[model samples]
Target: MDYLPLAQALADQLHADGIPEHIASLFRRVPRHAFLPDVMWGDGRTRYDRAEDPDGWMRAAYSDQPLTTQVDDGAEGGPGIATSSSSAPSVMARMLTAARIEPGHRVMEIGTGTGYHAALLCELVGDIRVTTIEIDQEVADRAHSALIAEDYAPELVTADAEKLASIGDGRHHRIIATCQVAEIPEAWLVQLHARGRLITPWAPTPGAPAGVLAVLEDCGGDVQGRFEGSLAFMWARGQRRGGHMVPDVDAVPDRITHADGDPRTLLDGETGLLMSLLVPGWAHGMAMEPGASEPHVWAVSTRCGSWARMHPDGRVEQFGPRRLAEEFAGALTWWRGEGRPTVDDFGLTVTADGCRSVWLREPRAELWTLHAADHDDADDVG
Candidate 1:
């Protein structure tokens, strides 16, 4: 039932991911299993209890993969969606390295899912210098208990991350998030210390399960940065992904047209990610009938209740106040004209006054301004 070797093996695996020496040492010092819940499982709630299956439990507990620890916001689970988890150790190491945390740096983390990363931060810095905020009370309480069990106590607060400014007093040297946010909040920027860094997953729209990780530094009066990696994390509860609005173009006699372009072809790879960027408040989903040859790519905009369906044969159906099909086609065209920049080519600029804009190539060439939260019926340029 010994777990040190297993924990060390996990640390070794993370080290292979190119984590720097100082950061790697911190991860190696903390026992990962100590932060896990009584039961461990995959995305699905398949419990692996340590007492019942010691070998299997230790294996899962130290495998360097995310362990789903809470479901339905910790509402006594019975086949509900997993809401939070301990991020995979490898990804955590990468994020920590990207953060470039220095000794005696004040660190604050959003979404302390299991307090594992917070504990790692405490190991790197000191417990008094670390502050973590979690939205779910039950999840935060569980993480608190786990932290205490390991004799590693950091300040744990249960509150919405959106209210971070009111809760997270004082400047932070480094800020990171365990959850994904649709847009980088102005609150995070205001609280970040001068030259401080904030690393979090930035999803283009609400409810997106996967997004590119952003490593931003406070640049004088603004916070700007670029995308580095991709990971899947739960969306911020208040900012939960829901930008999609189905267009009733067919239900009502609106407009049906044959499009010169196929979305499936245009939005094939990185272009799909670009489409979300070019057009704000819009989401793209693809589906096919049972046993169909190809799927129809649908673009739903919360902006004007507009919708476009690009069929496999390339016919496009559109409806609502705006012509989303044309919007998508145009966006794809502009993106290609820019030499088809990948996600890494993208950057963000958030001014001190809370004005946020995403740019391509450089900040001066501003692309779009992201509102703090998803509001109803915004204009549709997409």
Candidate 2:
């Protein structure tokens, strides 16, 4: 079972993805399988065991896809929700490139999921300059063992990433987070060296599995940056969105109205991105019942427990204090009026007071403010 060729093939894929040859070469240097556990979950939650199928596992280890390494936070006989994973090599490469790692720069990784990324950091900046943190004790311990076994030791800490200042003594040249956070912790900004860069996935609300990558650079007193691409990572532990009850359509509706536009289009691409920013603390998705003709689009407001459901015929049913569906429709209208800006045109500015403002095109064109973590309400217009 020669794995070098597979490693080379993965490197080739990374190179094709615009990764520099030197960084792509690191893929060839660091064997991904060395950091993986015996069991891994693939697409559709299909479990693969190295012991049972060595060749298949090897192939999957080199595949350009995320492998779920921890389910339900490593609990037994629980729902198979992916709690952690080895991010696709391409994603790691892109984020590493965004961080722009240098030879002597101190790097801090927020989520050391599989230790593979830590190994790459070690290769770039040496073991002494890298510090990786993971919230789950079990996950951290496993990553630590894997890293040590491979003789690539970095400072591995088992604690919540929210407590960044307490874990390390000094500021770092670069900081990267493996998990998505709704709010960028102020400590991350404060713990950065002058002109330091922090790369992480940022979602509009808690518990979102997918979000745009934030490539922020620290200014003298604030950290500001723009969204680049989308990344799907598990939410930060303390900020994970909890379970919410769905609104019953059978009950007497609080309001019945017609949607401003096609409800399905509200949560797609640029429109979806705008809606997330405009209507914070709301989760939306589309679902189709078995044998149904068309899917139903739904939105639920986490701030007020308001819910809205729209059928295929443009009819909307709302049952709560806030009109989430109406708000989403209004957001879509506003987006169109603004010439439909792409996610790339968006930027974020976090001031010294821990306030986050999402701007359009430029920092001065601030659209709205993202509420602090302690605030129970959703964001409001600036």
Candidate 3:
């Protein structure tokens, strides 16, 4: 009841976050609660029910924070992993702004989620020009019903969006993926118009400080763009991996060596981002064990199960095949050689043959090839 004022307030906050008034106004028109399920999860995975607490639900709906709409991929409660969510209004605005949506533009959204962003796309572009895709059929059906109930009918497709060859090439004027990918899929590049922009959240490895928002433009057949800012989203279904923690390995050390410095420093600032790209397929974490003198820094590779641990006293212990500690140190040396560039200093290029190349400053400055199979399972950090 009377949720318009709350929507307006949320829109105001979006405007304050640099979202254009015209785009933010869409929130005022479309109520966020209309797309949400009756039972939702908020911060700390706490449950919020519309029937039990109507006012709290309404306030949460209009708030700028994200609400989990589906958990455990629609399975009954097991461990409550958020599979899909209504992204924060501010992030939605930022991605929309990055998209540069215009009236009559053919827009394609990769993940429909709760259909809230799809509704916003309909507002920017006409309803007929919006085509939303959701991999989960149940989620897509629910979104379709919500959109229909709101008198907004757009093309809703329930299928995997990893490779959109079936959607045809040179179709969409703008393509946006609500999920994160390890690398840009070549199909997404092919499906865009000559001047189209593809925006998605990308994280090469778990060592990344944060997931980056990549706003790419197709140059002829090749796609390239700079990492604009930080934006963390859920992993795409095809690219999803298992949990990331210090791997369970042999108790006895295979090899030990002296570290150059505190290995934890590798997790600092842009170093982590650089390490993520260079040391692909590896996840890192730091913790002090019970009855331990100092905390240890651990790095484990998801691809090969290689593990490395650096003690607080600069002693590095490594096992398995890859020598992850050496690779990480080499990456750190390279970062220092390049003047310690930040995330903004990096950009990605995906060629016609699907080769991903991450560059520093400019594409020609310094580049590293990222193999398609080198994705990690670590979540993005702020």
Candidate 4:
């Protein structure tokens, strides 16, 4: 396939999306094909036009981009599930931009998915000082092989990234994670030098549209930083332990709410807008599944059960049994009570012992402080 044109097109798209010049140049410089394997390619008969090869899927390995190397590799269903892959180009660009890497900066990366990101780091900073860890042995080996093939190798380790302190001197200037993390892994905080910056996709807050880009500051104790932007990524492997079972909303009868008149109006009108405003971080809207030929209905999972709800307006009654809709609604109510401030109004303070998220109204004024443990399983902001 014609690779250069594909790379140019990808770059153009990134530029159009408001990516900075230097970051876009990095994409232009890295060859994506070097990172992908031949088996990952689609049938040669497929058209290579822009529509088909948008973002250079045909030349995924050659362009300075990320590709999905494996899907559902560890799950019971085999490879049908996208368990892992190289991150997307624009996503990588945004992440790298968030990292704000500088020359001679000591960098540690978690989740060496395809070694694609590692290669980019190697390009930006010499390989000698860059370290990356992957939890999957097979994936790590493949990434190592790819890096060796490209003759640009960095320190690749096949171990749990949660134990980051074992490598190096435990003093990295920058720490980045491509995978989604439920909590700020303690090892990262231990490894980062004072004033070091750590960037990662934090676990999604219930009813939020996307994960927050956690920018951590290593203070020689705990790490602290405010959210930079919205990011979504696959949860870290170890973090995905439990099966997503629906919650029993019926247990809390008092939380349920009902309205009169057109059901769709309640589901789609002010309630919807208010819900979005309240749970700005949630990925989907509240859905009411009317029972077949019956007034009884259930509120199903929205955005893949990222949020749940129970609303009934005569014609339809919906409730979530396995979801956190009630909790989401409560959070929304809390936000409303606080005047519905934008996300910018929120601030975070993390120490080695624990972390606290606060909503700030003005300089030196206290609003609310939510405590988040370093290893809490709850998907709230931490």
Best by lDDT: 2
**Steric clash count of candidate 3:** 0
lDDT of 2 by residue, 36-62 (tens): 989998877778899999999999999
RMSD of each: 3.3, 2.4, 4.1, 6.3
Clashing pairs in 1: 206-241, 207-241
Predicted candidate 4 versus true structure: per-residue lDDT over 249-294, tens digit per residue? 3433324444454433322433443343333233333332435332
Q: Give the C-alpha miss distance for residue 262 in model 2, angstroms.
A: 5.0
Q: After best superposition, candidate 3 residue 48: deviation in angstroms?
A: 1.3
Residue-level lDDT tens digits of model 3 in 284-316: 776675677777878887767678887777778
Candidate 2 or 4, higher lDDT?
Answer: 2
- Residue-level lDDT of model 1, residues 1-382, one tens digit each, is 6877877777776677677777777666888878887787763456888888888887888777778887776666466777888888888888898898888999999998888899999998889999999988888888899899988889998888776665446689898988887666667776689999999888667633247788888999588888785666778887775546544433452677775546565555565666666666666666675676877777776666676777776677777777876776788778778797787888776677655677777877777775545343333322
Candidate 4, RMSD to the unseen true structure: 6.3
Question: RMSD (Cα, Å) of candidate 2?
Answer: 2.4
Off by over 4 Å in 2: 207-209, 243-245, 259-262, 285-295, 378-382
Please identify which of the two predictions, 1 or 3, would achieve the higher TM-score against the true structure.
3
TM-score of 1: 0.86
lDDT of 3: 0.81
Q: Residue-pair clashes per candidate, as listed?
A: 2, 0, 0, 29
Instruction: List the global CA lDDT of all models.
Output: 0.75, 0.82, 0.81, 0.61
